[model samples]
Target: MTGAAQIAISGLDPRDRAAIEQLIQRHAWLIDHGKADRIGELFAEDAVLYGIGPDKIGRAAIAEWGRQRAALTERRSRHLQSNILIEPLSPETARGWVALTLYRHDGPGEGLAMPLLIAEYADHYRKAPDGAWLFAERRLSVLFGAA
Candidate 1:
């Protein structure tokens, strides 16, 4: 198995890992589909997101940012997440990284399309009282195609 997989196997519960993975996937889907108003549902009340313009603190601010982005009807985007690796910090907390590839364009299809950005998301998660995982913090690091 890969190093990250090995660490995940040793450090985190299988179910918790799966739940966190789903949380990550849901974030991508919501953003790609213009469901930004619900973006806060994936995060803790006081979550912080960095590396996307100014840092957004708290769920309200994050949701507002999402609303602003969703207002651009002409701009289209798809966020692909892969190479997810999750590690447990405590029963209630975990951390992980996801390889992010972003494809974006405006108006109709072009001759060819390419990813607009390639990056990794460093994520911290917290388990809620209801046993749901939520993003506590997420920081993006660009590997290429920064704009």
Candidate 2:
């Protein structure tokens, strides 16, 4: 198996791994569907997001950023995530990486398109008191295309 796949197979309980995966997927869905007002649900109260314009510290800041971006009605985006690998740090904490391929355009019509951003998210997750997994930190590293 590939290194990431192998590591994913071993660490974290199956249920926890699945939950984390859902959390990651939900983040992508929310962004793509313009559900910015719900963005706070995916993160810890004090989470930080780095390398997307400026660092957004705290859930409130992140939600505000999402709201502003969503207000731009002309822009459309699809965030595709893959190659997720989660490494357990403890029962309630873990770290992972997700490969992101973003296709975006403004004032859309069916036309030639290409990925606007190819990036990786280096993520840290924490399980909340209510037993939900949430992002504690998410750092984006762009490998190709626009930031």
Candidate 3:
């Protein structure tokens, strides 16, 4: 197990934990609501995302990627993150682990009942000069999903 995996939210100060938790929960809310333009605000200017799709670097690229994702109208999806563990490496840096579930809605008549993907994420974060925690790097590993 990595150092991040060894820490839990409960180990941190309540205020710090809450701040970190808000940063994470906001991601789900923003994506589900198609607020792509604002999504990039969650990450640092030079952040990187590595996952099943093409990796993205920098906030502009990440925001553009979100815009493209928002343009997908054929289906609606919901992303939920759970079991978030934040390990503060310093006052300005931290690592996190979270379990993610993605649910899909096929059409207007289709209920939002099917889970399309499940994954685990390991992430690094940094406190920006403005004093907000932002993702520096996010690495996602799928546990199960449709081909």
1-147 per-residue lDDT for model 3 (tens digits): 445444443356667768788988887787788776677889899999889389999988888888887776665778888889888876678789999999978667667476888998899988889888888998899999966
- How would you encode candidate 1's per-residue C-alpha lDDT over 1-147 as one tens digit per residue? 755556556787789888999999999988888787788888899999999999999999998988888787777888989999888877888899999999888776552368999999999999999999999999999899945
Candidate 2 global TM-score: 0.89
Worst 10 residues of 2 by lDDT: 1-10
Whole-model Cα lDDT per candidate? 0.89, 0.89, 0.81
Please, what is the TM-score per model? 0.88, 0.89, 0.85
Span of 10 residues, lowest total lDDT, candidate 1:
1-10
Once fitted onto the true fold, the runs of candidate 1 whose alpha carbons sit more than 4 angstroms away are 1-9
RMSD of 2: 4.5
lDDT of 2 at 42: 91
lDDT of 1 at 108: 68
